[model samples]
Target: MSALVARPFRLLGEGAVRAVRTALMQAVSAWTADWGLAPALVDVDVHRAWDGTSARALAWNHGAQSNGRRAWLAVGPDVATGLQQMMFPADPSYGPVGSATPALAAAGALQALDALLDALLRTSLSSQHNVPRCGAAVPATSWEYGSGALVARLAFGSRHFHVLLDGPAVQALVPPAAPLPALRAVDVAAGVADVPVSLRLQAGTARVGVGALLSLAPGDVIRLDKQADAPLTLASMSSHPLFHAYLGRCRDEVAVELVQSHTPVGEVQ
Candidate 1:
């Protein structure tokens, strides 16, 4: 006779699930701030299924009901092994009270999830290695609550993020490509306009022959062809010239200024 080996099972209780949702909201706030994303309004709650399955969902609401705008981002678990799921409402009939008209750019939900996940990784957070594949499915009707269209599945620790389209939505827009690493709230100041810039293409004279040979001396000087007052160039990830300013200290922290604009990064001009 052979004995079967049993595995330990852990289930989330009502109190524990509620606490987890609350913690997730805090995590979301930190993630947006760290990634320079327009912070999202977070709402977390616990949902249960009649079949004894229950889980918590994190909802990022973006829409207003008065203007027919409706869009939301929801992540929770269904009536199964407590895996995670993402749902997007495409129809407007069943909309949230203050939801804004959904926008096309909101389709970047997949990317947004990636940004949030990356932030989690940077913060050294561990997730269960049970992330499933991402996929989407469309519900039969707009008025049917909890109905949606699935787009695709994303891979998390053991769960995947799926995209769904059911209504108009707004997206957390990324700041236009800039020269500096990122734009900060303190970047905006009196007499300064926040713009993007990059120094990649700004032509710089390179050492060819004598400039290279003169470097052999211990105290040799190799002067750059550009003038010292020629607004020192700054760079972002794009082509636009953000702002030209010298670094300064504010409240014991280093800061920059948008002194002038040459060319807008990521823009035709």
Candidate 2:
């Protein structure tokens, strides 16, 4: 008995796919805008391999890197036709201006396709960090496909077209990951040595009715809730208590002597 095994294939990461889609959309938008056309990206997909079924495709050979890595771009027939119609809109009164019109339209479409490919290459290569520099493009007689490729669908009005990339091109569009910086031990005290912070001391607190507060005279005194001999709180600017202190006189100036550490609730002794 013979058993069949599924072949394993490598696919682009989600980030790479997203980057390719964005680059395509930007390139298409820029190209179409130059020709006074507005187009929207409909979808993007990655295929394991080209079926070699699409005929009359306009292709170009482009390098994704200076190290002889080659890639190919192909515009489907429908896309070429769409580009022709878009670049040369016919008047209804004239209605099919003759056989020469198709020839002219095809020529114009070819030029547009070349420009579009240039724009795509520029967008894909320039937008990424750590990506290898690409070389100039040349006219390709045929397309070579490998394990994977990318296909992006774009729509202008009701018409839709496809842009295809070979495996190398898809791989080229993916940027290399940037290396992370190495971690080293830092001096905790030295790092914050220059930072300024404010400390405060709390003598005591008193409560009184609003009426009594408003009726206070020049000599009026409010009794505090704490006893006179009780230690005051040494706190941060935000009033978070840090230590207990006792009132004292230092060089004819009133001061507080830190008596004990103030442990906050839920902390170990």
Candidate number of the best lDDT: 2
The top-ranked prediction according to TM-score is 2
How well does each candidate superpose onto the true structure, as a TM-score? 0.24, 0.41
Per-residue lDDT of 133-201 in model 1, one digit per residue for the tens? Answer: 222222233223332211212233344332222222111111223476665657334325455434442
- In model 2, which range of ten residues has the least summed lDDT? 138-147
Q: How far out, in Å, is residue 191 in model 2?
A: 27
Give the runs in model 1 whose Cα sits over 4 Å from its true position: 9-15, 34-40, 46-109, 118-269
CA deviation > 4 Å runs, candidate 2: 1-11, 41-66, 76-78, 95-106, 121-172, 175-269
* lDDT (C-alpha) at residue 129 in model 1: 30
RMSD in Å for all candidates:
26.9, 15.0
